[model samples]
Target chain A: MADEKPHCKVVLATNIAKSLLEEVQDGLAKIGRKPLLVGFLSSTDPAARVYAEWTGKTANENGFAFELREIDREELEDALLDANNDAAVDGIIVYYPIFGNRQDQYLQQIVSIDKDVEGLSHRYIFNMYQNIRFLDHANTKKSILPCTPLAVIKILEYLRIYNTILPYGNRLHGRTVTVINRSEVVGRPLAALLANDGACVYSVDINDVQQFTRGEGLRKRRHEVHEKPGWTLENCLPISDVVISGVPGDKYKVPANLLRDGAVCINFSSDRNFSPDVKEKASIYVPAIGKVTIVVLLRNLLRIVQNKIDAAAEASRENVSEAVQTSES
Target chain B: MADEKPHCKVVLATNIAKSLLEEVQDGLAKIGRKPLLVGFLSSTDPAARVYAEWTGKTANENGFAFELREIDREELEDALLDANNDAAVDGIIVYYPIFGNRQDQYLQQIVSIDKDVEGLSHRYIFNMYQNIRFLDHANTKKSILPCTPLAVIKILEYLRIYNTILPYGNRLHGRTVTVINRSEVVGRPLAALLANDGACVYSVDINDVQQFTRGEGLRKRRHEVHEKPGWTLENCLPISDVVISGVPGDKYKVPANLLRDGAVCINFSSDRNFSPDVKEKASIYVPAIGKVTIVVLLRNLLRIVQNKIDAAAEASRENVSEAVQTSES
Candidate 1:
């Protein structure tokens, strides 16, 4: 299997191994493309008493072999920089905790963009801009779309939303969505992406909700720059058709009690210790944000990874091609 | 003044005349800085026409001065590339048309970051992400804020919307804003930015809108990926207290007839002409779509542009500095 070309491989990067990651890896593996669980483990996942047993359980349950590996934090960035097609990695899955100081920069510093599992890197975002304006398809194989954003599309799918809901009044034309906690990696980046998908975007800082957008023109009272440059928690919340929140450990912020009644909330805010209260309030909470729609993002991620090896390989191949071309010329 | 010894000189590229360009140049011309306009139209500006022609009359009386030159269309991109401060041009303006083909990529390409007039390049946007997560200043000059976003900030100066509005009982935020187009020139990127600034962002595309985010949880939607995607324009409209629109041209299908009465509409749509009905309805149409704010935009634009040049210069200077240090050592 390692020698053969992969349809796609999922490189799951996380703080620890979990049943969801195993289920996904096994599910894909059964279908031929397995997922690599790159996470913090008590031991080698396959050797760990629990996972080794779970691996057998999950693999048999899904009809394929599940693989797991532990990655050193110090080596992660270096490994990312040096990754290539022959490098034994295909896609990437990042399951990280929100509390660490280095977590944010580390995630931002080296997204597995070259071999990105999801198109969450700067390059992919740039590619998205290009695709929208220039209609050019780039990094389709190597670009990784953020899973949360893809999940939003999935939510629309759950409701059976489609193009027919146009000319203004139906599904969500002229819609505006304000994302709280813009820095919550998945939520903020995903918001911009959702807007690009065709929704109007109202992004507010989770902390300083009104720093960028002051509520004027509309009926809301927003502060002036001269008076105060920040927004309080009160200035942050507003009526919305739906909410996609990933700010965890703050159940009070997204509990059933906090949401506008009837407003659907999709919780991507799950951690290892899933909260019953949070889940109860959430319209839906899942281990994977959205699966099928991730195809586009996955393809983009593969392309970037492939290109790294392709560039070097292509460079050497250029000599042979040049010889052939020289004769023709 | 053009010939005077300069601390530094950066090029200003815009869609306007060289004279108005010069006024900007003169205002910013201090001991170590100079702004050179890429193109100059002789007959228009007051500073250029009279140089001191009194009364400030007739609105068209003033002619602008300063260094100016115009380049042809095909050569425009090339001029920008040449102006990329390889030690020749300091910075570039690369102005957008009052109304023309989307100039986002064109703008990004010319921005060159630190040398970016206002650090409005793709590089800078990602840099902002790093800053958001790390709380580190971008370390470039102050010339990087996009003009439109800045204007919005300036608008907040007088209004103080955040201060006036009270958040809801559920910690429900006040107003939400939804901007439709994500043209790099203005739209999705801005939305993403606003997300970082902190607003709940619910981005939607035409199809996503058809799938209104009405019912269900995040996971329930995640599980429904097989369902079709649809969208309605109204679905994308902000349900919050405020709505800001920056879509350019007539193709923007935001049905004005559907706008909820009392919703403040700030239109950035310009086609050199407005329908009689639109003229009747708009509460405020910022003439030239924040063109007056261009000067402020220029402040960032020039800063980024100079930063790029300075960065390059510094890199080279470091080599020299290294050599000197080596010699001393």
Candidate 2:
């Protein structure tokens, strides 16, 4: 009895990442190139160092090239620009927590949209709307989505397949998904992506009430009345089929009883957003594995960008053929 | 009984349009310009003709310039380009249902994003995401939202005050808004806009299931799992706080029994989406008045574009001052 393992199915994020990395390598090799990603660490943050180490190791094991470099805050722009201009660099990712009190969001624009593996550029964020338009996956070739959201999606798919007892599979349609964080990096984008997939996404946060839950003083701001509903963590988690939290701390936020039976719990925050007993309560629990998710995310971006590049080349060939025909005639 | 009027208050869409127009005219006048719009009617459809006529009358009554031109199908692009190039033409609107069998979606792109008063351009459409970013209202000066959605928002605001019987005023936060159309011109954007504000938006349509709801064959299309739950016309109407429909045609689509008492009904379709008896059941009913909404929309767009232009000018002035200071130093 002491040796018996827990009854719940435990899914490994690294396994997901490894499978996706293989697919990406194959895709890049088909295009006569190796998977090359440049990781820029502009700060000495502990989290940043860990990510850089994992990325370097993963790249080596998968027969790919990963360059980890430390760039000063002032040189950050030049480093990104060089990567952008380099024909060999397939993708560029900047580790967060750059120097000073501000986020390094300004650097996101320096990376070419085509080579933006992090999916932080305005174009990528904007093009994410294409999903809502129901354009085929091919149409979304214009911009890559952020890694965390993409990882959340993959994990959800994984849970659907792994949890055979649950009636609802990977399909997000009609699934009540409650996202506990409303951040730009994880929670907000995940909500949008999930909603686009037809999931009833309840994006919950502590500060969502004044903005989402109650209509008030909507006087002079006529056309600006649009605000997303905010649900408290306690109220929304109970009803959620899939509960995802990205709160960036070590505290256990989600209670044991909050997650109903057969529910799937996913944490993106490096810190645990769920209680230790959550694994025992829920049908499936996906703990935060940033390294695994990042690998998978970069792989997805590589494949998407390759498709766009291939399509462009094909279009150019067609144009050349048409010009020759017209000239001959 | 014949002499007794219903206890409900009648909300006129035109009043809202007129007030907005006044504000727009004042805004333009401050910039030493008048509200000038050119309406290009490439189709002789009765609805298009009606819109053109109403636009002309409203422009003149508001001490603005409105020019209505009937152009050939082949000349549509040229006319739009001319308006785009013309400094006199502050706004350009092409009536729907152009000479072609298909909707003239291509023409939407021809209008520059800045001059696109209809908010049809891809850039403007994509940028509506700013609301999700919680950017201040002043920041949204860059893009104009689609007219129908803007009008729906305005109507909701109007209903908030007009429905004095209800304790909640003009705020849409926390309200469950059900949009009964999935078309880009209305429902989809409306849902995004509403959800951006704080309302729990339920986007419904007849065929949303086969495409957006069910997630089958989601393997190769990992990123393409676009699912929007399709709530049949019958199922979702009962739970909505504000029910807005853009289903075209003359027949009524919403039955009286579907709406809960105190629900607000809004129709953007020329034909009734709600049954005739909806007025009796709902606390307030706002019928689609295309002409009035269009005026309000055009006014809102004019103001937004003017603000952007003014903001740019102010920025340029500051830049020039800074440049001079640098050179002197």
Candidate 3:
């Protein structure tokens, strides 16, 4: 019986991100210019430094330019404003926890929407939560979703989790997903993204567990939320088709026994959120999603560049029309 | 037994709104000037015209100057721009469903943040969804909440549904609320607001049901979402301590039998969403919240006026310091 026990596949993010990175490289080559991503690092946290280095390396290898600006916490506001004004800087990312409070939130708004590669700015965040897909009335420019959440989405797609035969927005219909972190940047937004795509998303954290779903109706774009009191991992885990964890602590591990058999498990946190034996329960287990996140970040950068180009072209067209009208008049 | 079913207390929104209206009136008097609110009406909908009339009457009664600008749908863009540039206009309201599509959404963005009395502007909506309370770094200016949602919150507070004993921001800590409607302008934002204040909100619409809850930790302000697959009104109603409904169709009724005994019921729809016998199961019932909603709108106008004053003062203070520095140098 022991010899007959099935060994599940362990998937790597690097393998998943390979084709996406190439696609991003192709996108950049077509754009005909290396979009410069300026990253502001004001934190002394070693993890922040390492993440910035990883981003720089990823950007360089993928037909893009990455510049890390190490500045004092006090100078971050000025640096962000400068970057916002600089046409050369196509994207901006700030290493968070600089002030580590509401002040940090204020800092997020300083990066203009046009250059917000991480999609942390209010405009993008608003469009995302509202499930508004495009930036303009004409729907020419696609809205950018936050990198980590978007990466998880891409991973789910690559895994054939999203039913391609279903309508575009309802691809995750009948799917049940449990996201174990509700952090504003990753977990909450990721849940919203999934729910908007027609999944029953259980968003879990230390405080409580909440469920997210898109309301019925073809017109409903944004997801709605409901709270489930006294619900624990014990209740949700066994029912979840996919369990995604991003709890950032070394001591924490998801109990394999609670997970549904053959469930797909994913971890986005820097720390491992599952035991080595998680594969015994999970049909496909992803230990990390960092590489995929970098790819998504670059994809967002290309999107910003494309949006700019589209806007400029629109402006030129408007100007030509104006000139023709003036001459006719 | 039918007679012994018990008569629940009925609360009128007019009585509830009285004190708030007085407070707003006093606020306006203190400001020493009537804040002009310009409303743009392009729709032929009689409901829109009646609402415009109500707004004008309410504004006049509460020391606000209300002007209704009836224009063709084609001219609404120019009208909004004029109102935005006209500093005399302290707040702006546009009767929606003018185009009744994404174009209506485009029109919503035309209302400037500083003067958006409806709080439909992306900035405010984003902040509201994110649970961001203040608009600026200094925390001096309070972010505006959409009037209808804010009205529901106020009614909840008036009914003591919010546990005032708990610390602020966690007032609804143990409450289970079911809101039957996920309309963008009301139900969705209302659910987010309730969950942010610590209620377990079951946001129900025609299509599906969802759960909304704020995560644990004192620092977490925004509410998270989760989807409840196969959940219906029957599943949510009996568990809900409070049932708030805004379904517009007269045919749509929340079956009384499904409601929890002693549940608080409130309706904000033009059409009542509960049956006459709802009072039997309800400990408290509010048939309509339109009066309270108008009061909240005026309150929002006053707030916008106050924000402008504060901004002007800050500007002068900065100028004074700049002048002092110039002299010292």
Candidate 4:
């Protein structure tokens, strides 16, 4: 009887990422120039080095320029400032955890908002959390979201998790999601994004579980959070329609038996947060989303370039209007 | 049998506000000068006018200078820029709903961060939501909170709702709060603040309810939000230790029967949001917190002045260090 049970479909991010990469390639072709993305590397971590290599390979192959600048941790700030001022640099991203303290956070703020491809700056973070979609008052420019979280959202959409029949902002209405991890960079923002789209999200962390929802309304800019004091993974898994995990520890695993039958499961952690048997219970499983995340980073770079071009065009139009007015006067 | 039950204690904001006002007075005396707070009024709303009058009176009485600048809605941007440049103005507050849309939000961003006594600027809002307590990297300057929400926290503290035995940042641990309103200015920020302090807050609005909480960890910078699907006032009230309502409707009321026995209740709405019978169920009932809000506004003004002084001193010290380094080189 157990052998007769259907194994869940395993989805890889490569195909999804390839299509998105094609879209980026098309965008770059229209621009007629390779937009330079400068990557700041100050960490000795092998993982960071590997990620940088991958980013460079992908960018160079896909009609974009990628430059990796490896510098000492102490000189990273000066390097960042130079990158920010460089006319050729369209976007900037730094491999984080250089100092692994509040100082690292300070360095994030050092990246200019205009060129910050990582979207870690205060302005972007604030806009994302507040659900402000546009950068300008007139809504001409769209605000950038952090790439990793945006990657998760894109994957979910690709998996047909977001219902298309529903209205634009409330596409995930009636969906119940459980997100494991509360990290500021990835997990927290992912949960917020899910909730903003109208999913009831159980934001499970090491300490406790919290529920994130937008409540039934079109006017809500962002999701709301509620604390679930005594809730455990066991408690959430049984009720969750979708389970997303990003716990960074290799030893940590979400027990497959705990998941609701036919529930969709996704993991974004570098370390496996789910066991091999997750497919037995889950209707769909995404093993990794790193490829999608990289493409999203490239997408953000393109957006930065587009925003700059738009601003310049707007400025020129204003200048022409002012000149005409001055001549009449 | 219900007749024997004791009526709850009625807590007034007057005494609490008086003490806080004295603290502001002492702060001004130490500074040896009054900090001027400029209020921008473009709304024809009577409530705005009365509030402005109250602000002016309270500010003058508490050793602070207040100026109400009535201007056309169209000139608000220029007026805000003028106040931002004015050296005499230590703080600036704008009466909201001037344009009653996204434009009003734009006006909020127009006030300079240094002179934004209302704490509605992007920097303060971002800090508040992220639970970043300091204005600067060195943690010398404390970030400011919006006045009305700060008043709610102060009221809760006065009621001894915060457990002193618990560690700082976790004093509101084990508490369940329900805040009925999700307005950007007060309800949402108040929920975030309480959750950051380790309380389980169910943030309710006209459309729906969401829970806000910081998972049990000292390292958690801000509260995570969760959506509560199909949750109602009846579902939350019995579990909540505190019920706070700021619903701006004359007929709105929190049914006394729904609240947990001996629960604390507070209403910041202009209209009474709770009935007289609520005293029978509540341990403490606070009908208003307007006085406390005004004093908090004044306190924010003092903080702006202090932050400016600190920045100037730090700049001078840096200059002295640079001069010494130049001579040595």
Instruction: Give the best candidate by lDDT.
Output: 3
DockQ of 1: 0.02
| Cα error, candidate 4, residue A323 (Å) | 0.8
lDDT of each: 0.40, 0.64, 0.85, 0.83
- Please report, as a value between 0 and 1, the fraction of native contacts recovered by candidate 2: 0.00
In Å, residue B69's CA in model 3 sits off its true spot by 0.8
Candidates' TM-scores? 0.36, 0.46, 0.51, 0.51
Candidate 4: tens digits of C-alpha lDDT, residues B183-291: 8878999999999887779999988999897543223456889999999998899777689999998999998888765577899999999999887666568999999
- Selected candidate, larger DockQ, 1 vs 3: 1
What TM-score is obtained by chain A of candidate 3? 0.96
Total backbone collisions, model 4: 14
Question: What is the C-alpha lDDT profile of model 4 across A111-207, one tens digit per residue?
Answer: 9999999999999998887778889999989899999999988887776666553446666654678999999998888888888776778999999
Q: Tens digit of lDDT per residue, candidate 3, span B209-294?
A: 99997532222456789999999988898767689999997998889988765577999999988889886566578999999988
Q: Please provide, for model 2 over A52-153, each residue's C-alpha lDDT reduced to its tens digit, 9 standing for 90 to 100.
A: 888778777766678887888789898888888887887787888785454467777788876777778786786564343312465544446788898887
Q: Residue B257's C-alpha lDDT in candidate 1?
A: 50
On lDDT, the stronger of 2 and 3 is 3
Task: Give the least accurate 10-residue stretch of model 1 chain A, judged by summed lDDT.
Answer: A1-10
lDDT of 3 at A101: 85
Residue range with the least summed lDDT across 10 consecutive positions in model 3 chain B:
B1-10
